[model samples]
Target: MIKHHPSETLLAQYCSAQLPASLSVAVSIHVDMCPVCQAKVAQLEAENAKEVFSESQLSSSTVKNSHDTEEVDFGTDLLNLITADPSIDEVYEVEPVTIQVNEHNYELPRALTRISHGRFTQVGKLARSRVAIDDGPLRSSLLHIGAGGEIPEHTHTGFEVTLLLDGEFSDEEGSYVPGDFIWQDGSHQHTPLTKNGCLCFTVVSSALHFNKGLSKLLNPIGNLIY
Candidate 1:
């Protein structure tokens, strides 16, 4: 059973394109894992689509005005922008971008560059590459992360999932060793530091929204990673 099914209202909102970017990422993951919730969301979308068609007198029902489809229309229509630029459909399922992130070779606080890291150190080495940025708009032919060594206390403006690759890190949440997966929603905050100079792999949707004060300091670095 899905432990956290987003509220029905939330699922509806997501289907209606009314959720935040980061929370939407988390909710999509939930739908991938939970078929029951997925079905419900799909049904809601179908109903909305049907409503749209019915208003145009395109209903399957031949009876006049027998349909109870609600009228829901927005003021200004948002256009679906699509370009035939041959590259538009170029979806990237690139090889997991790698990171060597060892204590000996690189200096502390260096951002990991995909081109720099050889084909050897794969991205998210510890856990299965579960969460990845597949959103079509994100520029993914190249992805980068800072080897800043220490991640400060932070709260996600969206969902943050980390998979320890070669080293370990710990915070108020718990100690995460290589292979252990950690995920945090928008509501939780924690300060994480590497205990043994670890190499970590992480995926974030939308930037982390730091709390305040100290968070201001973190915003620069944290925003860079996401």
Candidate 2:
């Protein structure tokens, strides 16, 4: 019963490999958890493949008479590229990785398991683990909110994307469960809180701007903590 999803435009960009690494990873993790999005991505990929095949066929037809040598087989070349590694076995498997926060353990999504993440940095009831992805100003991390934890009301200077990995959380907007993909920009501001606790995968393009009284002082170290 996942309600939030990446926009269709975002999904298209993801299918075409047009998004930045951090955003792409966020969308990928969402697709891993959402069956609806998984099917949509599959359809988009098929359509893209069809278009590429059609263009390749047209190019091959136009060059058929001009070449004296045998025509290169693109499909064979692709197959060779896929199976070029001699050490690759007939089967491959990857074990899931788990993270611990406040004595609670949660398994990471398959997409995240492939990437490297650093140690967690704790600040009161909140903890954040930076994901090692170099995408210029875009920062990615795993944010864990312990029970009764709450983030101060803040607006984004650029953009923020959060994918709920486990548990539930709520804001001025509404409650979000696991697999919810929440996107926010400078126009939106809210304080997020969890009752039972929650773990989220988040990516931020820039530092946050706290709106409340004393919390505004945290604006300087927003990027470090979030």
Candidate 3:
């Protein structure tokens, strides 16, 4: 069961295609694993459709001297625009992509497999590999943390979103299992630990800022690693 979820505002932004690409991907992947969020997104979409239809009807009633070429099908166009992107609602069991780590293979979330290009780069001494996906304003990665691994206590400068894909991990708040969506900002700081290991898809707008201990030394070079 997923204990954490993207807020209703975030889900509404996702439904309206108003979120940035990286954040959008995070929400989409969460929806893939969480039916509750999926249903919420669907309801938002329906409400949007209703608003568009109402506006279209009002516009059509006020139109005068309209030519065939000048007239536009607002409802059709809006519906197409809303539903055209399969990333939001498509079922992706046709072609699954898997990545290997420490002699073990893990299947990536469908939303991630589309943008990862099947590449992972090793980072740190722990069993972790960061698969990069650039999304303009945000930096996205697929992070794999092996058993007993820990991410040093750190805070964020901007915003960070993490979507758990496999296994379990715990932090100051609680333990997060697959499909859990965690959001962090500058004011938050915690060390993430995995007992049985876990794989996560993460999006960060800025490099993580380590708050204490020896990890603070890496602050100067954090951008290179985070």
Candidate 4:
């Protein structure tokens, strides 16, 4: 019942390997959970391969010969493109990984299991914690919002992407469930609220810029904290 999805352009970029590693990871996790997106990406890859091979410099006879084995070759090429690293499956099978918040342990998404152990910093009175991922210029984090918790109204300094992994949450945009991918930028501002708590994988190019009430005062230090 996932309604929200990454835009088609974003999916195209993902298929072409044009996104940042962090953004790509977020989209990959979403694509894994969403069969619709999965099919869409597969179709895009198929079309891309078709266009690529059509423009090849192979002789007409050579192309005709390859046509006999084109299906198998296309499948192999698509597999390699979608999964650039063969070790990803092995990593998933390594162990069960979880992120601990107080007495509770939440299982992370398969794409995130390996990196859940990074530094986790608690925030606010709610059971929220931010786990920072070192992605060079692109800042990413694991954001856990406790039940009934609400984040202060804020806008982004740059682009932001949030992929819900567990539970549900809502904002000015709409309610988002697991597998829903939310993309926002500097022009957008909203206070995210969770009724039954949620775990989200998020990536931000820059820090957030608070835009309301007492939270606005944090603007001076938002870049450092976010």
Tens digits of per-residue lDDT for model 4, 52-74: 66644222223223555543334
lDDT of 2 by residue, 13-84 (tens): 999999999999999999999999999999999999898777567457432324566564566554564589
Error of 3 at 212 (Å): 1.7
What TM-score, computed on C-alpha atoms, does each candidate reach?
0.39, 0.89, 0.83, 0.79
Which candidate model has the greater TM-score, 1 or 4?
4
Reference-based lDDT, each prediction: 0.51, 0.90, 0.81, 0.79
The candidate that wins on TM-score is 2
Error of 4 at 110 (Å): 1.9
Q: Name the runs in model 2 displaced over 4 angstroms.
A: 55-70, 75-91, 223-226
- lDDT score at residue 114, model 1, on the 0-100 scale: 19
Q: In candidate 1, how many clashes are counted?
A: 3
Backbone-clash count (model 2)? 0
TM-score of 2: 0.89
- The segments of candidate 3 whose C-alpha lies over 4 angstroms from its true place after superposition are 55-93, 124-132
